[model samples]
Target: MPRPPRGAILAVLAAAQFTVMLATSIVNVALPQIRAGVGLSDSATTWVVNAYGLAFGALLLAGGRAADLLGRRRVLLAGLGVFGSASAAAALAASPGVLIAVRAVQGAGAAAVAPAALALALGLHPPGPARSRALAVWGAVSGAGGAAGVVLGGVLTRAWGWPWIFHAVAIGSFAVLTATAACVPAAARTERARFDLIGTAVSALALTALVWGVASARRAGWTDPAVLAAFAAAAVLVVAFLRIERSAAVPLVPPRLFAAREVAVGNLLTALFGSVWIALFFFLPLYQQQVLGEDPLTTGLGQLPLAAANMLGASLAPALVRRVGSRTALLAALLTEATGMLWLSRIGAHGSFFTDVLGPSALVGLGLSVAFVQLTGLSVAAVTGPDAGLAGGLVNTTRQVGGAVGLAVLATVAGTVTSHAAGHQPPLEALTAGYRTAFALGAAILAGTAALAALLVRRTPADGPAHAPAPQPAASGRP
Candidate 1:
């Protein structure tokens, strides 16, 4: 197999990523059923999701390093195997604790698969227009998978049962693993580096503690001593983690990646978008429920615009980048998102999704679709093949950490508004107040991203890197 046909290989890798990410969103819509079937308290069901995120985010860097050392295909297959087995176990679990445990393991498998597959993609395709086109397709596929997951999970859970969703994950995992075995090539052997044991522990603990504090803060007042302590401890752990990274043989995050002003600002914009993205999923259901009086199924349907637009934008991203360059494209995209969010935040009690939500979602999806490709392209473009895995890890790590923090912060803010409005207004009024607060804050976040983009994400032709390639990918030129 002379490289397994580059186009087909890209397709297979894309399929593998889609299936893993699809499992994530699909499970969210099925949360209620999962709780009933597995005997989880409402509070505990949130863990079913968080458990996965915690495992996935915490160990992703380690997984990327594993690919660099153990080989990408090996980790991919191992991840698939673990993910499938865990899905099967999750489907069969009778107790909430057992189900939660298996879900975390399943996420660990995902963490391993995701970064390795991305690293493999970068390796297989050189930094050129072809690869950029492939990446546009790949990024779009991922976004589509996530968007489709909600609908699919809802349908499956309604038709078969929540357990069937996990069973479906098992089936999907097996299919991708088999295809990966055939299409994805194994890298030549490399020396295994010492696993960064101390760094791993610190990063995991710090993230878990930080998210835990924020999530719990809604129940415990912000002034609560425990909340303050957790926040303080998180700051300390972060400082310590940085210190460890500064001296470690293999730093968790390479400091030099931020040397490019564009990369640093681009990543910040990404982090803000990441937060807003998750926040939509978190609070939109409330708006649909309280405002429009739609049920869970109908609520999911309302989000279809975002999904459709995201896929649409993804397909267009490569061409957009080809024309405008990564830096300019990112700034344009951020501005679009900010505009959409501001419109969405202003919706009155009488407003409809068709009028209020759809327009912004369209912009958001389009904006994000373009920005992600450019961000990923710039992150690894300067590095050699050997460092590609680490580059992939760094980008994904930024996303996961951002999502974790952003969701928590937004949730806390929404909760605060809801609490303040509870006695000040009627039930629907209070709920709307809180939802609007979140949306308004999101608007601010996106606007800030736009400003950052203008300042940091744009290319300065005058001060371009000496080694920097041209601004965008050409038909045969590198991205």
Candidate 2:
């Protein structure tokens, strides 16, 4: 058969990425409708979101490794199948337990789909202007997907019904699956080593516990015994996973990969970036609804400016990277986002969206999207062949885990501030105070990350080689 057009392949990969990210946030607007429709208790309603995140975040490493051992194309097809089917099931679910279970399945499928899709995208274009542009598109889709989800969820839920949200995902998943099968070429798998079952299990458990603990801390207070136990268990399992990787002939996460400074620093910055990225979405809607007295649909519409800015930034990032070095571009992006966060901190209870939200949203959207592109490029710079999938998975894992932890911590901070302020102020003013404090802290975190990146990241020429060398297979392991 003749090869498919490059545009077709790129579209398929971008669609897959957008779909995965959309699933992460699309249901937020429909949560109330879903809860009432399915007779869910308050706790179960929260699980509708948590279950998906836990499964997705926990299985990412394993999924990425699977893509390496299995063919990336093959894994991508399998994940799409699972994701599509699970989406259909979720749409049909009539009970709370069934809905949550299907959501988890959807997340598991997404976990498999995300890394495979990203690795395939990297393989499609070599390191150059072509790859940079491809990554720019990738970054745009990723950053915009969450914001777009809010809009789509509101529209779909209000127009058709809550189930239409799942229906839309199901339809999109199958469409992407068909397109990928037709357009994406299958590559031969080179790694013939044994799969690291122990490492996969241990690492998955540790990530699950850690994400669950932090997520629980948001609702059940940080001091709750169950939350403490979850954190402790996660710590112990992490230590065990590290020890296992050292001794295992074939480790799930090759410790040597971290020897690449780009991978290390890229992931570290991604974590900090992820924290702010997720928190921004979480708090912005609250400010609009609780303080500005906007409805869900209106709040969703309010995010359009941010989404547009994100796309604009993504489009501009490749040019910026070409003009200046990635290090400099990244620093600039981070500072821009920090400035936006600081601006957002000035939001007031009486503020209007135009005066208060629009300018900062534009700044944040621009900065966040550009920073994501740079970080992604850096993270995978030194990876090639078999490790490409692993690098893809590692970067994504850091982002998701960081977002979860960041949101939890920020929520705690906001809650504390709100409680203390409530004693002396009106309800709306107290809530605004909490939101402002969280945004200020978020700005501080971004500034701190930029400072660290400036100190640690090595400068390289535009379109130049990676700072670190590609990882070699461990001497003890056979390939």
Candidate 3:
């Protein structure tokens, strides 16, 4: 088969990426509809989102390794099949249990797709300016995809129904699948490499337990027996995973990968950025809906400025890195992010969108986009070509896990603060206080991230030193 042009390949990959990411937050606006339709309680409804996140975050490492061993193209195709099927099933689901189950399946498929898509794009574009340009496009799509998910969800839900959102995803996934098979080249597999089943099991179980514990704690309280049990189980399983990696001949995650200063620092920063980002998405919609009396569609429209700003930030990142150096750029962005979060913390029950939300959101979006692209370059800098997929998986895994954990913790804080303030203030005022507290905490997190980046990230090539390593051709099952 003749290879497609590089641009065409990237377009397909970006579309697939967008679809996968869209699934993460698209349902936010439709949550109320889903609950009413399925007769789900508030606790059960939250699971509709958490189920997907838990599966996606837990299985990502295994997914990344699968791509490297089974082949990126092959894994991507399989992922699309699973994702499309699951989306169709979700659209048809009538029961709360069924919807949650299928959403988890969708997440598993997404885990498979994301790292493979990234690795494929990286493989196609050589390092330096070419890779940076490609990454800029990819980063922009990712940022826009998350925002689009929320907007599209609201539009489709209002116009048609909540189920239509899933239907759209299914159609989009199928379209991308067709394009991928035709345009993307098949990469060679690692013939001798073995899957680390034990490592995979422990890591997945550990993450699931941790995320479940935190998410459940919001309703169940921190002292709940179930939550305590889950946390303990997670700790034990994490230790087991580390031990398994130490002994496994072909570890799912090579322990040595974390030794690189750039990789380590980059992942930490990703986690911090991801934490605030997820929280922002969760709370801002609530602010617009419950506090400002905006409908779902209006709330979605209100986010356009942030999405546009995110694109602008991605487009400007490469230049910023060139002008200021990766370390300095990252530090500045982190500080900027912190400032935006602080600004947003001033939200009030009577506030207008332009005055209270727009400027701060755009600032946060810009800072996050710049940080995302720079971090992507830093995170993968240490890995050999053979492990690029693994590196991608690790970076994404941290962000997802961090976001999940942070959301749970932040939600608990907000809930507690709101409950306390309700005794002394009006309901809307209490709610605003809760959100402000969470945003303030988020700002502190970015400040700490900036300090870490300043101290740890080197003042060198954002993509790493030119002589760090050479590309090793991946094997194809066929000679």
Give TM per candidate: 0.90, 0.95, 0.96
Segments of candidate 3 deviating more than 4 angstroms: 188-192, 461-479
For model 1 the TM-score comes to 0.90
Query: 352-419 in candidate 3: lDDT tens per residue?
Result: 89889999999988988888787887787666566777777888898998898888888899989999
Ranking by lDDT: 2, 3, 1
lDDT of 2 by residue, 73-189 (tens): 888999999999999999999998899999999999999999999888877766767777888999999988989988888788888889999999999999999988888876544
Q: Best lDDT goes to which candidate?
A: 2
Q: Could you tell me the TM-score of candidate 3?
A: 0.96
User: Cα deviation of 479 in candidate 3 (Å)?
Assistant: 14
- Model 1, poorest ten-residue lDDT window? 470-479
Looking at model 2, report the run of 10 residues with the lowest lDDT sum. 470-479
Displacement of the residue 378 alpha carbon in candidate 2, Å:
0.7
lDDT of 2 at 233: 100
Residue ranges of candidate 2 with Cα displaced over 4 Å: 189-191, 462-479
Q: Each prediction's Cα lDDT score?
A: 0.73, 0.88, 0.85
**Of 2 and 3, the candidate ranking higher by lDDT:** 2
